[model samples]
Target: MTLSFFDQFMSPVLMGIPLMFLALTLPWALFAKPSPRVLNSRMVALQTWSIMGFVKQIFQPLSTPAHKWAMILTSVMMFIITMNLLGLLPYTFTPTTQLSLNLGLAVPLWLATVILGMRNQPTHALGHLLPEGTPPLLIPLLIIIETISLFIRPLALGVRLTANLTAGHLLIQLISTAAFTLISIMPTVAFLTGLLLFLLTFLEVAVAMIQAYVFVLLLSLYLQENV
Candidate 1:
């Protein structure tokens, strides 16, 4: 019974090959291609408008030097949000829910920011480890604590995204299962549960988008500190 709830998280297989790649690429295919005409389709125009707004909001707090990452960051946010929202659909897989995939995305970007900081301003980067005017007795301990905190950033990023999505999915699954089971025995209770499920589903959709934004926003903040 427990396994039934979590089994959905496993990547679906077709002819012994994982379909995770297909799930990742399907979001791109869902968007309408731009036409070579003067006027575009309403869907294409809406997508373009949304993307432009997102890019502007993301780059607003970034420095000019960091603006070069605009494309990569925006693409990542879109990919994550798409996967998250798609997973809400029946029988769809979410790659971002996997800790491995989340970590893969988080670590490289986080490390790039850290490495950029070290390369461009080594003194400033290292200075984060030890504060000014610290007593000689507590300097070493403070440095150790700060160093640990610095290295934990990428892990925090990966775990935060994974945990939030996983928790939401689990709650939805549990409530849905209970509602289904109660339909025959207690129709009224089941109806109420279904209503609750409806509200939860909407909240989960918001969470899906917000989590993607937050993940990208944190990376930008990290880049801001570095650049």
Candidate 2:
């Protein structure tokens, strides 16, 4: 039976049990646990330093109130980046490529930011729906438009991630197949295609990391507006 290119996205199973949970939880265990000693092992120290740097850069533009989310946001970025990079490996499924998973992640977080804004600064949050200098004729239309945009933020977040990863994975599969098929017929052409595939793999690696960062960064921007 010929497998479809899209089959790669399917969650794998072992004896009828889904492995998605295992994939999701596996990344956390891969990290080094901190030691009680004054100096950590190299792995632990490197992990700590990288995390600190990531958090600082993400929160650089935000006010003190937003610093409270440093742990949550940083943890999310780490989780997502790990999952994305791991998905690029052979025979692995990418959970983030699914709209349901992405939406599950995005909606609650985006809603939290909006709800926080509504709770702590009701007027300021509501005011975002309408500009201060709106013309009398355009006020209603502008408010409607802004409201739609506000609600669409989460959907955009989920779709943007799902689409980017899905497209990249599909392209990789297609190119690799072409290279494999050409191997016996035209060795030189197949070699060139294989080289192209190698370069694309590196590009996808960068994309995986960037998409994860962009996902977190957009959420932080949403939070910035609220807090």
Candidate 3:
């Protein structure tokens, strides 16, 4: 989308908000611990894991390369989600909608798949990716489809996130403008639309987190399939 004059000039500066928030805020969020009165990201992830039926595991988390990659993936998802929600603040441009922002998320994932796949199992990964020894006649068709599907993974994730945040922001903007126009900034229609926008704001936050999770999970599953 083409930005307005103000947006054009401001978009570059505004985009940094997410990076700064993730870089600065995330460290504090991670180091803080769970308590009776406090809720932290780690605690929340664990709680969500349990509620989602991943409990009863006794094995300690390994320090293997696989483990590290998983941690990185989870951390990136959380950062993206948090920044997305932050960008939903009134009048702030959300960076998640930018192609550059989503590309940052996708490129690393693609690289990780390549690096970790070979590291985990070289021959088997090749098999999963290529499925060698198929009939010659069908080989070209299968290869074409596989190549397209392989490349589309990142694009899918990026577009999903960018579009969701951008669209939500636009909706809020429209409602906000219409409210001001119709209600003279003083009364009933104003109050109603304002409340509606507020509700949409919260929903946008949830969508932000969900898109991040979907992007990360899809990456994981693709890796898993190849493994």
Give the candidate order by descending lDDT. 2, 1, 3
TM-score of each: 0.95, 0.97, 0.70
Candidate 3 residue lDDT tens string, 26-145: 433643355675555776667567433311121123233344455566666666766677677655556677777687779778767766777877887666545668888988788787
Candidate 1 structure quality by residue, lDDT tens digits, 82-117: 899999998788788899999999999999999999
Name the top lDDT candidate: 2
lDDT of 2 by residue, 181-223 (tens): 9999999999999999999999999999999899999999999
Off by over 4 Å in 2: none
Candidate 1 ranges with C-alpha deviation above 4 Å: 1-3
lDDT minimum window of 10 residues, candidate 1: 1-10
Best by TM-score: 2
How high is the lDDT of residue 43 in model 3? Answer: 61
C-alpha local distance difference test of each model: 0.91, 0.94, 0.65
Output the worst ten-in-a-row residue range by lDDT, candidate 2.
Answer: 73-82
